[model samples]
Target: MTGQVALVTGGARGIGRAISERLVKRGMKVGVGYSSDPTSAENLQSEYGSDRITIHQGNIGARGDCERVFDEVINAHGRVDVLVNNAGITADKMLTKMEVDDWDRVVQVNLSGTFYMAHLAYLHMAERGSGRIVNISSVIGEQGNAGQVNYAATKSGLFGMTMSMAQEGSRKGVTVNCVAPGYIETDMVAAVPEKAIEKIVSGIPMKRLGRPDEVARVVEFLADPESEYITGQVYSVNGGLHM
Candidate 1:
């Protein structure tokens, strides 16, 4: 993916940030899109400098905001070669206990946000007749979580979207795929109770939580030119946790 122009949504931290840095290190001009967190974006800018990195602030669920970020990067980099839909939110609750707001909020950001970014990126990539898109899904999306019904739903929806998009983009020389991360060591996972975390690790054959870099590495692979022929596939980086 070297020399490719890539955009990473929710790049302020976690897997998104790792993906941004990895793509940048590979010689790509990266667009770091975040809903907020100027400090993190500023840090990325410092590392990459303004000439190579463009920091965009916007809500991924908003089409206008998505367009703004796309335009910002296109105007600066001249084109978009890759798109990573990594923006998502979690509103954990059992189905019986989930509030309407919780369900709506998580769905809006996680599922709809991916659609918005892909929708906008599709327009650009379709025009160019080439691009790569990776959506960050969750293993929970495959195996439902006890208290994350809504979150799981959205993520699972992303898998469906990924396949459909891959079919559409294939005719245009674009590729779409998804990465399902299992228990990545991000701030979100850090919130789980110690014992619960231990239980999670024990279930993994590797006996450890996955790292953000683990997820990012998979994303980078899919973004590669050789990967152009492989689309609509779901690659799991769960350390045997969800197999």
Candidate 2:
């Protein structure tokens, strides 16, 4: 993967950060895309050296921002060989309590944002006849969560989108795959109350929460050129919680 370029949306923190670091360790130049803050991303670039890591800031929910970010990445790195659609937002609310705005916002950032970035990357990769696109989903998407209807919907949507995109990209040597991670130690998961987290962990067969690097490992595998024959599949990292 040396000299290859990768664009990782939401690459500034949590699971995204682990993925970005892993790719860089594997000798790939990474474009780290963050929605609002650039501190983490910039810090990563500093640690990895600016030549190996480039920071890009934009709201993935907007098509215009997606276009500009994509162009910026390409302009900085010359080409993109892998795209990780890891950017997403969640507006948790019970179905009845959920406001229209809450649903719309989550849908826009999680589903629509992924589509915008993937669509752009797909075109570039298909034209080049080689590429990998990995979508970061969640275990909640597989097993619907109580207060996360909107989030679950968008994450589950990626499954169908992955299959269809895989078929379309197969002939062109591009692959699309989804990674559904269980409760990992991310800032998002950390926000849950301690008691809630304990309850969640007790249900996992492994009797523990997953680590971000654990999820990133699967993503790293999927992004490898050796994974060309393994598209349109979902690799669960949920520690037997959902499977």
Candidate 3:
């Protein structure tokens, strides 16, 4: 994958950050799409070298921003060979109490954003006859969770979208797949009440929260050149939480 260009949304922190770093270490040029946390984004750029990685600051929820990020990456790297849709947010609320804005924002950013980016990247990949896309979904999407109707909806939406995209892109040699991570130990998971966290860990067969790097490694495998036969698949990195 040396010299190939990869774009990772939400690449400045957490699982996305780990994916970005892992890809760079494997010798791929990377474009990081980050909405905030300039410090982390800048650090990635500095550590990876400007030629190896370029940080594109933009909100994935907005179509125009997604366009800009893609344009910037192509302009810098010549083409995009891989895309990781890792940009997402949680708006936790019971269905009745969930505000309209909260639901809309999560859908816009998590579902629509993935669609927009994938559409654009698909076109480019089609022209080149090759590409890879890995979407970061969640276990709650498949199993469902209380107080997370909006979040669960968006994450589940990714599964259908990935399967469809994989079918469409498979004929063109462009692969699309989804990764459903369980209770990963990230800042997002850290916010859960200690008791709830304990309950979550206890439920997992591994008896522990997963690390971001564990999820990142699964992404790496899907994005690799050797994964040509794999498409329209959901690889669970949830420590057997979902069987």
Candidate 4:
């Protein structure tokens, strides 16, 4: 993996950061894609050195930004061997309280953005006859959350998209998979009300939120060249919350 190029969207922090660091540790040249705030991306590049990592500033939600990021990665690294669709946002509100803009924003960034990036990367991967794509989903996608209707829809949409793309990619020696993480200890979860968080933790069998690295490890495994046979599967990293 030393010379391979892996593009990880929203790799500036949280789970995305873990994934990028893991890939870099395995010696892959990484493209750290960020929608805003290059601080974390810059840090990763510095830590790994510019030769091993490059920061691509762009919004995955926008088609033009997606194209530019993909093009820049190819120009910088020659080829993209792995694509991790880890960028997402939440505008959580109960359906009754949710505004149209909130729904559109989440869907555009989470669902549409995934499609755009996957399509852009798939073109290169299909031609190369080898590549890996991992879509980071959420457990709420499978088991709906009351205030997360829009977020859940986008995440579940990723499941169908992953399977269909995997079928198309199979013949080309490329694999596409999804990872649904539950109650992860990230900044997103940190904003939950204390009472809500406590209730959530009590419901989980693991009695704790999962670490980003735990989820990242699964992504790393799926992104590996040897995991070509494992495609269109959703790996749940929720500490057995749903199982």
* Best prediction by lDDT: 2
Estimate the TM-score of every prediction.
0.97, 0.99, 0.98, 0.98
Q: Any idea what lDDT model 4 has? A: 0.94
lDDT by residue for model 4 (1-243), tens: 777899999997999999999999998989999987778888888888999889999987899999999999999989999999999999999999999999999999999999999998899999989999999999999998998999999999999999999999999988999999999999999999999999999999989999999999999999999998999999999987888
- Greater lDDT among 1 and 4 belongs to 4
Q: If both were scored by TM-score, which would come out higher, candidate 1 or candidate 2? A: 2
- C-alpha lDDT (0 to 100) for residue 80 of candidate 3: 96
Q: After superposition, how far is residue 51 of candidate 2 from its true place, in Å?
A: 0.2
CA lDDT, every prediction?
0.91, 0.95, 0.94, 0.94
Which candidate achieves the best TM-score against the true structure? Answer: 2
Model 3 per-residue lDDT at 11 = 95
Q: Model 2: clashing residue pairs?
A: none
The best-first sequence of candidates by lDDT reads 2, 3, 4, 1
Kindly report the root-mean-square deviation of model 3 from the true structure over all alpha carbons. Answer: 0.8
Give per-residue lDDT, candidate 4, residue 217: 98
In candidate 2, stretches whose alpha carbon ends up further than 4 angstroms from where it belongs are none
Relative to the true structure, candidate 1 reaches a TM of 0.97
Task: Give lDDT for model 2.
Answer: 0.95
TM-score of 3: 0.98
Model 1, span 85-184: residue lDDT tens: 9999888888898899999999989998899889989888999888899999999999988999899999999999999999999999999999999998
